[model samples]
Target chain A: AQSVSQHNHHVILSEAASLELGCNYSYGGTVNLFWYVQYPGQHLQLLLKYFSGDPLVKGIKGFEAEFIKSKFSFNLRKPSVQWSDTAEYFCAVNEGAAGNKLTFGGGTRVLVKP
Target chain B: SAVISQKPSRDICQRGTSLTIQCQVDSQVTMMFWYRQQPGQSLTLIATANQGSEATYESGFVIDKFPISRPNLTFSTLTVSNMSPEDSSIYLCSVPGQGRGYTFGSGTRLTVV
Candidate 1:
């Protein structure tokens, strides 16, 4: 079975700090990767996705993730995070050919202090 | 991306009661999924709602506990039967987006007491 792992369980940082959340997946075949964010008292929203082509994918809100197939990792990064970026982030994976059944990782809670 | 409308954004229910959550999509989609997110946990896929057929449940989730109805391409419902405090969580509905990504509904947070 496919699984995703987020190494960081909780991260606390001051504003303007560089952000990098590590995500690794266990899958042998082609896969689609995604990063999702959930604000306090809100629903999950897509931060970025990687299907094919370039490894670096930029998403809304100044978020970006790089898909490194050889490493089996798709890590999310932000040059500088703001206090508004405080949210829970989740990394998900789906078999490329399998419609959209996602396997998610334990989320990482980010607290950005202003 | 498709927009999803989920009803009863938050509900407080008594134990042993049942609650049905509804999800309506703005556009037709081939795949509709139901997921459960327990407190401090990742989202777990509950089942895949198939149009005109029985839903396919994932491991640890059974049809008896989570009955699903997918009548068409844009609508589905999931009913939690005989809920307990353990069932208190956020239930979300999702659909495949145009880019092979997913669009999720504003989850329904259930609290059973």
Candidate 2:
């Protein structure tokens, strides 16, 4: 069975601070990676995704994530954070070619203080 | 990305009652799935809503508890039978699109008393 792990439970940062959320999955086969964001009282929205050909993938809202295959990690990052960036972030993974099922991490709650 | 919508965004029901949640897709899709998100827990896949056939449930879930119906490619429904307080959570419907990514609905938040 494949599972995803989010190293942090909660993250608090001041505005303009750098952000990094670590994500790792237990899977040996080729996989697709994604990051989704959920603002307060809103639906989860896709931030970015990695299918192939790129280790570093850029997403909406100034967010980006790097797929480090050797490390089995896909970490979400941003150079500076804003108060509006406060939300819960989830990292998900799906197995190779014909895979349609997604395994999601426990999720990290991000709080950006002004 | 396909737009998905779920009805009864939030609901409160009695323990013995049942609630049917509806999921509508803007366009026809080949795959639709239902998921549950318990408080502070990772989202769990409930079942794959199969078109014109019975749903395929995941481990720890069954049709007796969660009956699903996919009448067409663009719409589906999930019913929580004999609800309990433990069943209180957000129910989300998702559609698989290009790149193996999924588009999720706003989610239906259910609270059983």
Candidate 3:
């Protein structure tokens, strides 16, 4: 079974601060990566995904993630975060032949203070 | 992307009871997924429901405890049976959307008292 590991469990930052969340997965074959965010009292929403092609993938709300195959990592980053960006972020990996079955990492709760 | 409407956004049920959560998708899909998100935890895939076929459950989940129904291409239901406090969590349904990404439902918050 594939496993995902997130380096941080909680993050606190002031508005306009740069943010980065580290994610790593253990899977040798082709894999699809995703970042999903959930605000308080809301459902999980896709932040970005890496299926193939360019390593850097841009997503909604000014978020982006870079897929590094050699490192087995797809880390989420933002140049500057806003208070509205406060949410719980999760990293998930889908094995190529797994047909959308996602293995998720323990989530990281990010709190951006205004 | 496809839109998903899930029923009983939240429910407080007594222990040993059962609760069935329904998910309806706006578009037809081949497979529907059920997931559980415990408090302060990440989402865990429970099973995959295929239209007209038996649902495939992940390890640690069973058909008896989390029975799933996929009666058609656009709808499915997950029933949590013999609920206990440990079963209290947010249950979500997902389907593969355009561009290969997955769309998630609003989620059903189940609390066993």
Summarize candidate 2's per-residue lDDT along A31-78 as a digit string, tens digits: 999999989889899999998987999999999999999999999999
TM-score, one value per model: 0.97, 0.96, 0.97
TM-score of 1: 0.97
Candidate ordering by TM-score (highest first): 1, 3, 2
lDDT of 3 at A60: 98
Can you list the residue pairs that collide in candidate 3? none
Candidates 2 and 3: which is better by TM-score? 3
Kindly give the number of clashing pairs for every candidate: 0, 0, 0
Please give the distance, in angstroms, between residue A114's alpha carbon in candidate 1 and its true position after superposition: 1.1
lDDT of 2 by residue, B1-113 (tens): 78888998999999999999999999998678899999877789999887888899999999999999999999999999999999999999998876677899999999999
| lDDT (tens digit, per residue) of candidate 1 on A34-92 | 99999998889899999999999999999999999899999999999999999999999
Clash pairs detected, candidate 1: none
Candidate 3 lDDT over residue span A2-90, tens digit each: 99999999999999999999999999999999999999988888999989999999999999999999999999999999999999999
lDDT of 1 by residue, B1-113 (tens): 89999998999999999999999999988789999999989999999998988999999999999999999999999999999999999999999888788889999999999
Q: Model 3: how far is B15 from its true place, Å?
A: 0.5
By DockQ, the better pick of 2 and 3 is: 3
- The root-mean-square deviation over C-alpha atoms between each candidate and the true structure, in angstroms, is 1.0, 1.2, 1.1
